[model samples]
Target: MRAAWAIYKRELVGTFCSPLAYAVMVSFLLFNGVVFYFFMDLVASNPSLSGTRGPLQLFFGSTILSVLTLMIFCPATTMRAFAEEWRSRTAETLLTAPVTDLQVVLAKFMGSMTLYAALWVPTLLYALVVRRYGAVDWGALSAAYAGVMLVGGAFVSIGLLASSLAASQVTAFVTSFGVIGGAMFALGLGRYVFTEESQLRFFSYVNLWEHMEHFAVGMMDSRQVVYYGSVVVLALSLTVRALAARREA
Candidate 1:
């Protein structure tokens, strides 16, 4: 347990101390600020389009832009976990440490997630800014952030899983991006492939679009909780297994 915490702190410090972290932060804020301006402008130009009275609902996780942002940023964030170590032939050294594979995996995962959460922390300012201009739905805003974090969990775990498998950071990012994008495409394909209502409902249950929409409206579905939680566990478990396998190799 102590070894795990030590590994976690080491991973956390490695991630935060890197220049990549700052670059990702600046890029995320810059892109998101532009998206915010675009939405606010659209809403302002057509008053009726301001359905929720603020941009938080749309900006948090509702739009494809939000999805794309994650697709782009998360891979870069998690790619170096094991991939870089492997690339530099340090993975053997890392894995041979006293900590168990499970601890190492969890440590790297939590480190990536910490940075993921940091990227969203700035968006709280969006809520503050919205409050100054109009009545902000703080509950809904809170729910939106919660939903986004869960969504981040799903993707960040996937990224780390990919990182564990690949030999280099760039390859890890591509692997992570491809798998995540393919899964999303397959889910979207369900609309046309499954004609039955029950099948449709099942696919929708796993759909990121509806997941964010529900959260944006302050609707917390238990099914989504289970879905996201299950994905997180599955991905992280796979990561641990990958680390164990690598240790043996």
Candidate 2:
């Protein structure tokens, strides 16, 4: 446990020491600001957006923007989680250390999740502003944020797994993006090909959109929470297995 924490601290500090983390933070904030402004303007023109005192409209707007930004940023953030260490031969030292492969993988996963959480802080200003000047439902807003974090964690786990499979940073980045992009678009493609009710229901069950919509509407569905948690566990398990196989090889 101590060894894992040491590795976790090392990776967390290393991430901030580079310009990449700063660039991702700045770019994410800028994208959020632009998207929020556009949504606010649209709401101004369409009174329907103002009907609900709840933050669902604003939450949905921000949620979509956040997911898109995360899709682009998370791959870059996780690209070097394992690939860079392997490239520089440092992975050999770590693999041979007095720590299990699962511990190492968990440390890297937590470090990346920490970075993603840090990036989400600045966006809280949007919620504050809406609360002060506009009608907002705090319960729904908080629930939506929770859902976003869980979904982001799941995506980061997937990225970490991709990083383990890659031989280079570029390969890791590309693979991560491909995996995330495929997952995001899979339901739509499945719908196009499978017209039957049973097949469509199965595809919908596998879709993030289907699950996220429930949370975005302020419903705390246990099934959705379990679905996201399952993804996180599956990805992390694969990552640990990959690391063990690499050590053997």
* For every candidate, C-alpha RMSD to the true structure in Å: 1.6, 2.3
Give the alpha carbon lDDT tens digit for every residue of 90-206 in model 1.
Answer: 777877777778888888888898999999899888778767766688898888888888888888999999999998888999999997778853585576578899988888877
Residue-wise lDDT of candidate 2 within 1-249, one digit each (tens)?
Answer: 999999999999889998878988898778778887877667767777677533444545335554566677778778889998889999989988999988999999899988888887877787777767677776777677787787778888989998998999889988988888777546434865788999897776666654555555676677667877898999999999998787778
Off by over 4 Å in 2: 53-66, 188-195
Predicted structure 1: lDDT: 0.82
- Candidate 2 clashing pairs, residues 3+ apart or interchain: none
Span of 10 residues, lowest total lDDT, candidate 2 = 53-62
Score every model by TM-score.
0.94, 0.90
Q: RMSD to the native, candidate 2?
A: 2.3
Top model by lDDT, which number?
1
